[model samples]
Target chain A: MEAAPPESAAPITPVLVAEHLERKLPGDPPVTLVTDIDLAIEPGKFTAIVGPSGCGKSSLLYLLGLIDRPTDGRLLLEGRDMMPLSGDERAQIRLRHFGFVFQFHFLLPEFTALDNVMMPIRRLGRLSLPGARERASDLLTSMGLGDKLHKPPDHLSGGERQRVAIARAMANNPLLVLGDEPTGNLDSTNSARVVELFRELAHEQGRAVVCVTHDPGIAEVADIRVSMLDGRICEVLRQT
Target chain B: MFPRLGLLLHIAAMHLLVRRRQTLVATSGVAVGVGFFLAVSALMVGSQTDFVKTLIAAAPHIIISDELRSPSPQPGVREYGKTGAVELHGYKVRNEVRGIKDWQQILREIDAMPGAIGSPSLSGAVTLRQGGRDEPLGVVGIDPTIETRVSTISEKLRAGRLIDLERVQGGVIIGEDLAERLGLGMGDIVAATSARGVSRSLRIVGLFKKGQSGLGSGTGYMLLREAQSLLGRPFVINRLGVKLPDPYTADAVAKQLEARHGYKAESWQERSADFLGLLLTRNVIMYTVVSAILLVASFGIYTAVSNSVTDKRRDIAIMRSMGFSQGDLQFVFVVEGMALAVAGVIAGWLFGFALMTVLGSLEFPIQGEVRHLPLDRSTRQYLIAAAASLFAGIFAAWLPARKTALVDPVDILRGAV
Candidate 1:
């Protein structure tokens, strides 16, 4: 059992750090996405990257999530160099320590809510069948989806499907959770609920949470607000 | 066991279930292919097996005749290569016995060998006269007891017993067609004139029906003693028939026996070479049809999987993000094809068995009795059909599965933010 963090919330070792990260798409005229980014993601903090559509905020989030490779920078996971790892190795790392929630629920339409949550745990192979099932059921129950555990994504409402996606993201107990407009398609109430869930996932569970979104709700509530313009972070504000 | 096999199968099953219509069409295509392959192959191969068995049972596995495989070279050809300016036209050959002199001893030797029986027969062309009508025919003289062990002639007897040739003195057995053509009946006497110009009266003792037109209309059989007296060929047998337990070994046995006896030993297979050639041609045609069916069936699976991959692009991206490897995705899709193929095999077996049963129950008219269609319903046919169906299904799905692996989650998910 872990004791709750004190009110002071003393600084601790960062879980991920990006040092001057950059990515360029190769072509006759190479297109540059993100440039000169220096950021550290501390545990127990919800960080939101907010910008215009072409500001490369999602690109930066992708780089941090290990889902995309940086063209010219060093990335460290818990201070260990991630620059030399292969794509497959990066995917493994993502599977083991990072969970992602996209704007669309993106649940495999053929699988039930419980199966969607169980997919990651089953892939990690750390738990047996019954154990994985139990974990998914318990997580869905906690998310108020116990009644809809066996329903497919199409059978659920927008809000319920998004909750299932969130539950899926946290199924593996990942150290970091990354989302790209996780509540973009949800109603206002659902968006607010999703924001509170991300906040809880970070503050209560002690995990780093990062979101790239145009939604002002997430921007207003995030613990750390990162504002970017034309592929560069122009502002970083921390709440007291 | 495969790693994460249960999860992979679950995912594959879910995808297939979601696209039930496409799956059914694909599976039914394979099932129809398998059913046709099994049913047609069984019928064709079955008929071929029936024909070969009939040929085998009709006569001895090997026939040792009083003849030379290669006649001795002429003196002129041996000495001068036929170009010495001395054209030898007139021929005078050495005088020797007309038949095998020690046939009884050869028969005894063959009988001593394991799983072999040898029977002797004397055959020649003769003219028969019945009430002013004269018909030239071929006749064979056989011992009643030894003939039964080597040939199927005893089974063809329709009227009189084979041993009646010995029971009724001066008796002969002739085909029913030949007897009818001569207007002769059992116990009637006919004059038999041998090629040697000797004549004798023979009583009709037996009537048989043969499948061959030539044999049924112009052949006769008699006791060996009577043929010897009538043909003026005493105590000499011209042919020895050897039967073996395994007909397939006839060629080797024939070669060895011919080498030892300095006679022309013809195996049944050698005699049926033309028939076997026809059979081979037919089998090639059958397999080509079967292959075409499977190829078409494979196209159905390929189309189904390719369409599924296109329709489920979003699911593929999410699964990749969830840590499922590309190889894992490919395996799942290919196993989807294998699942359909297995189901097809099961369904195909039922359909094929019903087809064979229906065919086997049908009767065709032959001579005076009924004969059902021959069917080779061996277990091996099912195994071979299943193996082929599965292999074709796997190969067909493999290309689409590879395409599934190349799916770019980044491209598909770029708009999420």
Candidate 2:
């Protein structure tokens, strides 16, 4: 694996781009979730999508994460059009190149933190059992969850569970880590800690971190902040 | 791919383990179903086997009779090689001796056939007269050495060997029931009158029991020469009994012989077709009724997996978001169903075998003979039962597993979180 790029290095090409992306749900009057959205996500950067509830922040995040298809637009992953790919091919892309952390910290309660982290690694089928265990342990340890590796989600605290979810998202060493309100259920201090970890994952480890949030404090730590209103991006601000 | 499938199986197993009570209930349901299926199969198949065995033991595989099934050409009317233009007026059928002419040549041909043992027999209706008590009976004349090869009666003799019939010229072997009814013992002289009204005094040298009262009380066996003299048919035999190594091939062999010899050769299978058909219908009904149990048990599996799928919707969405494909989600639940089915099948086989053993050990009277319950021991029955349960389990799991696989993560996540 390549080492994380330094923050001061020369600019690199964007790994993911969405051009005029749109999503609409059929209804008596069709409900447009996100429309006319254009965004480019670069490696070694933390980007925040901040919006109020019902403003389609999570919807846009899902589209970019490949969890949901765009209604009408082109999505490019590594400059290759992802719209033409089949569902299974898209799933393969997600499995290899992207990881997702949801707001509820949806760790499988039956499994311990270590086993939960090993899920993606095992699904990818690139690592041996022992290798997966070692990598999961290392990821958890880096997240300051070394002592809580054996605890199931039901036994872990809210903050510890969310951190475990984050460790799981990074299990396959994905190029893009997408989080939808990852700190929405966390306390202030825990949320701050999670925000700092997200920054380190982007700036130090050279992976792109895209997080949807309602907290202004989390947006303050991002290299770029995107604000959405009425299903459209109102502003894109470069913070640093 | 195997390792990935293994992971899916592990996940499935863990899901079942976490809900141990539900899993046990489902597994036990299938086990009970499979166990009953196997037990019923064993009983049904075993009874059929016993029935065929009893039938084979009672008669020869094929019986060729001297009487032609179709009428022969009338005398004075030339047929086949000659031109038949002369018709006789007031022609009547002659009363001739009821016996096979040229039977020695026929028997030679039959005995020459592969896997065939042919024995000439003289059978006629007779009256047993002992101290004015007259009882109607069927008498069979058998060559002791040859008849022993074609029929089981020689093995079933109780009082004397079949060779005694050959040693003593007028020796007779009567059934025990017949002997008791006549109040006659061995060495007692009994007068037998044939259908042609020829009377002869015979010494009862042996008593045999045929296991059924109908056959045992009405049949008698005697030497061939004595029977021919009593029946007033000299140097003639009416029936040829043939035994074959493979009784099921009797029909083909009988057909071949009948076609060649122009005699009515009846195979035991042809004679017992109705009984065999009854057995087949009984088997179909048995399997249909038994398979219903497995179907009911599969419903139990469906219910358990359906409940799990409904309860694990959020987990499914999360896994999907984490890049698990729809096939993976479906495989996990399918594996769960198969695991339960496999466990149940194993337990069922043991339970079924145990049940068969217990039943087989118990003895009861059947047709005046002590016999144990017949239980088939072939592995085919077990495999069929297992395969049935597995198929049912997988079918039951399919809908719910597919539902789990097709779940949209966005809809679930938007509503849930």
Candidate 3:
């Protein structure tokens, strides 16, 4: 895999948009996590969300992935309003359209790497067992994990586990992939390899990618950079 | 969305396999509960049915006697209108002789009713005197041929036969217990005095052993004519015993007979109502014990599954985030609980069968007969146990599962990471 900046014109329409989004914990003196947020995510690009600690970057990622609902404002996917959908409906949209990679890889310990990757695909129920197995195998092989298909998560290295998690997120061939500091636990060599993979996934694979990270290298290489502070985005920078 | 058995079992099997010991403990708890329930119910209900059977065979289902449930209304009250009636001052009720003079007609009417066999007999108190012993007895005068068909007396005779009551002059059949107590035997003659003042010399022709202790020592049987002569009430039979083919029809038949004839009629069921009520109470207590055992077993399942939910919180969150619906998650855990119950039920039925077999093999001597402890090894008890335990398992599993599935998974995933 090779990493290069896209030579194509950016699309005008965003695949997903959040308008004035806000989430608050309900209690005495309610604590607000994300507030008055507006953002657009486009296909075929890697958008890096960079913020300091305690800046609600992860909270915003949760809302964007529809893993968490905003207390206020609206979330839209493909120009369709998502605020009216039920929780199960949101889950269905997530299954069909979005994938997530957490900082810890979050692979089920009892399952083999292939089984872990095939979980979401199997739940989608659109494919037969052999078909799902083949799809999961192909995704893992593309991520250079073909030989470790049967290995449990505990037996794999941190980078390999993270790659397996990535393959799982992509098992359904989602339109967008989201990661929360996925390489935070990896060595520099592994981190650089993950960075190259994200770049190739955005450019060659023609998929939208978003990562919440403190890694400056990801910001330097991303197609767009979003900076946040105090639950609000303060700046947005684009690669001409 | 609810998952089918394939996915449900896949996850459930993995969870159970991972915690084999805990699952086994839960299953064993249910199995023990089920086993004991089957064994205890079989024994208790078996005894109840056996006791009723004994009662049905021991006496006539209905007895019509020369008695009144209530006194006849005063003649003065029956005669005049209330406004014109005068009360009698210092009046005394007349002493009336108690005998069923129309017993023959009543017996024929009863015998004509479908499935009823009526035996005309006299019941009176008599005192018997031997060389050095005297015993007070309740003597029942029966026509041997008809009485034997109505009662189990033929099977209870230890010496001679009921027909001997007719073969000998003034013949009497005493229970062996009474004869043994008096040191008397067949062919011995004894003087019997009536409750009034009449007396007669009677010869012993038969001896019966009840095999049960209650009435053996005080009961004697004789020919109807001999008892009437000894009791000084010749030509009058005081009781008409009606035996029914189906003992369960006793109550209705007794009621119908009493309404037709103005005599006090009593069914054996009514006579033994208190005992049958006690049996019903015993059954309630037995089932309560059964429920207690299974309730405690259900707690074990609840604890096992609850602990699993707490321990697998992260895994649950991951699966929830993977788009498994709440129903789907609940299905996995519920299946695990029911699987434990199913295993327990099978194992428990085997254990119970063995226990019943062991109990059924046990024999004890009562009076003169050796009898095995009664055990109702009916299939219904197994089915009841299975239904009860499975329901308990499902309930136990459902509570904790709902708690885990309905919670906001974001919180669990957040806590884990």
What is the C-alpha DockQ of each candidate? Answer: 0.53, 0.70, 0.38
Q: After best superposition, candidate 2 residue B388: deviation in angstroms?
A: 2.0
Candidate 1 chain A lowest-lDDT run of ten: A1-10
Clashes of each: 0, 0, 0
Candidate 2 backbone clash number: 0
Clashing pairs in model 1, backbone N/Cα/C closer than 3 A: none
Report the Cα lDDT for residue B50, model 1.
91
lDDT of 1 by residue, B1-417 (tens): 232788899888988888899999998898888888888999988999999988898888999999887875656568777565765567665567778888878888899989899988898888999888999877888898878777777778888888788898888888887888899988899999998999988899888875653255677888887888788899998889999999999999999988888888999999989988999999999999998987898888899888877787777877887777777788888988888888878888888888888888999989778998888999988888889998999998888988976787777888632
Write one digit per residue (lDDT tens) for candidate 3, span B1-417.
222345567778888888999999998999899999999999998998999988877778998988878865666566653758576788776666788888888888988888789999998999998876779989988899999889888887889899988899989999887888888898998889988888888899989875543455788999998888888888898898899888999999899988888888999999899989999899889999889998998888898888877777888877777676777788888888889889989999998998999999888987657999988988999999999999999999988988765567677666565
**For each candidate, what is chain B's TM-score?**
0.93, 0.94, 0.91
Best by the DockQ measure: 2
Model 2 clash pairs are none
Give the higher-DockQ candidate: 2 or 3.
2
Look at candidate 1 and tell me the lDDT of residue A24: 89
**TM-score of every model?**
0.94, 0.95, 0.91
User: On DockQ, who's better, 1 or 2?
Assistant: 2
Q: Summarize candidate 1's per-residue lDDT along A1-240 as a digit string, tens digits.
A: 122224435746778888899998899798989999998888999999999999999888888988778899899898778999976777778889999999998888778999999998888888998999999999999999999999989999999999999999999999999999888899999999999999999999999999998899899899999999999999999875
Whole-model lDDT values for every prediction: 0.86, 0.87, 0.86
lDDT of 2 at B132: 80
